[model samples]
Target: MTAAVSSAALPALLGPHCTVDPDRLRRYEIPERGEPGKASGLVVPQTEAEVASLLATCSKNGVKLVISAGRTGLVEAQRPDGEVVLSLEKLDQPLSFATPDGEVFRFGERAAPAAHADALAAWWRGIGAPPCEDAVLEVQAGMAVDAVNLLLAPLNLMWPMEMGSSSAASVGGCIANASAGANAVCYGTAAHLAIQAFGYSGDGREVLSDAPAWKAVPEDLLAINSAQPRPEWGLIGTQGVLGVITRAKIRAYAIPGQREAALIPVSDMPAAMRIHAAARALFGDDVEEFEFIGKPALELVRDLKGDAFRSPLARHDAPYYLLLQVKSHKAHIDLAGMLYEFLADAVSLPEDQIGYAPLKALKEIRHSITEASNARMRALGGGRLSFDTATPVAVFGDYLKVLEAELKAEYPDMALIAFGHAGVGGAHLHILGSKDAPVARHAKALVKIVFDVTQDFGGTFSAEHGVGTKWGDEFIARAPAEVRAALIAAKRRHDPAGTLSPRSFALDRQLAG
Candidate 1:
């Protein structure tokens, strides 16, 4: 039998919409982490007022709550254990647009000269009408990223950020994870794209909107929550433990007219770094996306994809390959020509060896690598362990060497599959461990090695992926005391009951009676 909610008053307050039936609640039990847990009940609120009321009622009734959105999180942040599962699914709504009045929202920092030129030209050809200046998109918490992009297409604007799971990722969940997409090198992360975040405090004390650099609280509270060097509004990445992110105002960018993609094979990381520098100099901000896939990863994709999958490096025996995309707002800018010219000077591959593919086709190869790896892992009856850690751009090559050396020494049989934004020094590595090995033991040992090495090099253990229930221990162990204290204080102020996603960020310690 499933555990029951602490408050019978919840059902009375939320009406028939709140469900305690086991059949309906069973589905909420398994979150993205695929953990075993039970939800006492499920609540799906439609309006911001309803959300605020639900949270207020939960606090008043002494009930725990876990916010669920898109259900795409990998860290088990939404795992519910005899708590009320608050689903944002019904909060989905059509996006609204408004011209910034200079207070509610503001235009993002002016793009560099290169990006400025690109944006202006794209704005001029605006679906037969002039683009509106200071246009901003107001998105609800539950709208999927792909749906949001579709809505913006009429204005020739897009969310700019590109993630592998955009098809199912929600705007709120992306902010909650501080997710970075493929184009993050130029477009930035969700935290940067979001200009305003509006949500109810977990304890229902306040219904507020936290915008960039806007601290509408007492100086004392700001000193506690915003004390850390990291931006405080980015608390959206805290997984709604502090509060439920109901809506966000995002800064949109114009879609580029001229876009081109190419695959280049390099002999080593040093060579890749040289190419990276050359591309930045040539394209400036026009270099929208740069992805790197080691030879091992490329081979894995090719093997799984079969005859239909062709490699861009068919003739080259290089150890690394880059999938690069260049987008320009100017119609006269020949992106393909630029790619060819850069190649002539940087790596100097023969003309016949050039593998010029369309932007969409090249992206397919990049995304397919992860898909193929997952398929292979399933076939072998073993799970894949992934690490998201980014080192300084200059020392990324050294970091890679250390990672490879440690992996080889410890687990020679495991396959090392890594692909990510090489320009930003973020590598998403998937290791396929032995099917016979114990999953718990392997995961613990491997995670320790990765975190320890990452810290030694001054790299973050959790990069784009936020630490959830799984990494709470690691976060507590590694985070500086002052930083942790600031976060806890913020949690206490926003979620006095420790009712929303309790135990996240080690906030559970404050909840002990």
Candidate 2:
């Protein structure tokens, strides 16, 4: 049964509203686990003082705590194992703005521009919430992400975070998981977006907020970044274990007036690489996205999404089709034209043949194709596989070849889909259909094979996705001995109790005592 913290530790702090609710316990459970339940019990604290008091109580009472956000995490950060969850659900706020003397609150700590954006995102996407001018918004840890994005529409502002599960994810949840999405190539991830945050130790006795520690971040992020390490605040990837983020400020961008999307003909591998090279040179950071799907992927997109799925290659015999987009009128049309020229010159593919479908239709094509492909793969029964990895941007084509060769050698019968942001060198390599052989043996062996190749290439095992519970052993096994030790030491110094998602990594050796 799920239980709350000991009354003896700090009964005065809890009062009446703090008592654990019976139904709330079920909310924390991993519904996917069903019978083999993981997390249970949840604590809802309305204020930072309450959060601190809760943590202090939990620590004093020898209890472990896991921060719960939107619960949409794919790697299962919130996948609990009977821990008492500190649900930031109650920490909600209304829309307020940051004018010169902007609205500020002394909740856990004053929110920053970064946190304001995150709250803004969560506001638009949640419930009846809609974005208002100079909106000052705050969120509890558990608000769903889609709910937040929905609210953002009215304000003409948008959170850069765009995950597949955004409809059900939370702003705070995405940050807690340090999440990323397909659009990350252009915008980066949660870590980059988060500007300021307030963190508290399990016992609430310890508190950390970047607001006080963080010096002013510039409207020109580049200028601020040039100074390196923002003289004031510590990095945030290690924030959770270092301290729990109760509230945060995040980076946000103006909503694009209209998006331009098209499919360009990539005649061959070299031609595809050239397009990316030229595109990057011209668009620089504004290049929202550029991904190449092999002929096989396009065939799938066509077969699954039907005739609406058109590509620049009319014959469907080309080597690849690159998904292209030019976001906002602020984007340079000349750059897009240059990219078109690069593709045409590199591989004699005429620009006319590399025609584009408009942005609105392009949206349907991408969304429809991806969803359909996923459905088709799952429908075949249960053996669909996926591997996401990163390689250096220049050697991306070479990396794709290596990945294809290795996978083909292992399972000739399966279908492989090469999709993801080539700009970031991260590709989603999906394996559709199962091999005639056993999955665990083949799948595990395949992962090992790919992991070794990636490591050899000086590429990281994880680019966007952090090493969670499932990847712990693999992550430790992959890292150099010293690196692992340093990570462990850091975690201990920040969280000596192993309180923040204790199983995040296997720290039993250093933290076991």
C-alpha lDDT (0 to 100) for residue 287 of candidate 1: 82
Q: Please write out the lDDT profile of model 1 over residues 333-404, one tens digit for every residue.
A: 777887888787566877755678766677878888878877777776667787777766666667777887
lDDT for predicted candidate 1 compared with the true structure: 0.71
lDDT of each: 0.71, 0.57
TM-score of 1: 0.87
Q: lDDT per residue, candidate 2, 1-513, as tens digits?
A: 124444333234444444345465666766321122354456677776777766666655566666666554434456667666666766643234332234343333445434655664454455443333334344544445555455455567666676556666656656644455656566665655555655675445454444322222221121111101121233245425445766666544667655655677665655677777776665666667766667776677678756556544457676666776656544445544655565567546565766666555554555554566666665665365555676666666777777678878877777777666665666666666653443444677777877777666556555554555555666567766765666677666656666667766555443663
Clashing pairs in 1: none
RMSD of 1: 7.1
Off by over 4 Å in 1: 1-10, 99-128, 132-134, 207-231, 315-317, 437-439, 510-513
Candidate 1, residue 129: CA error in Å? 3.8
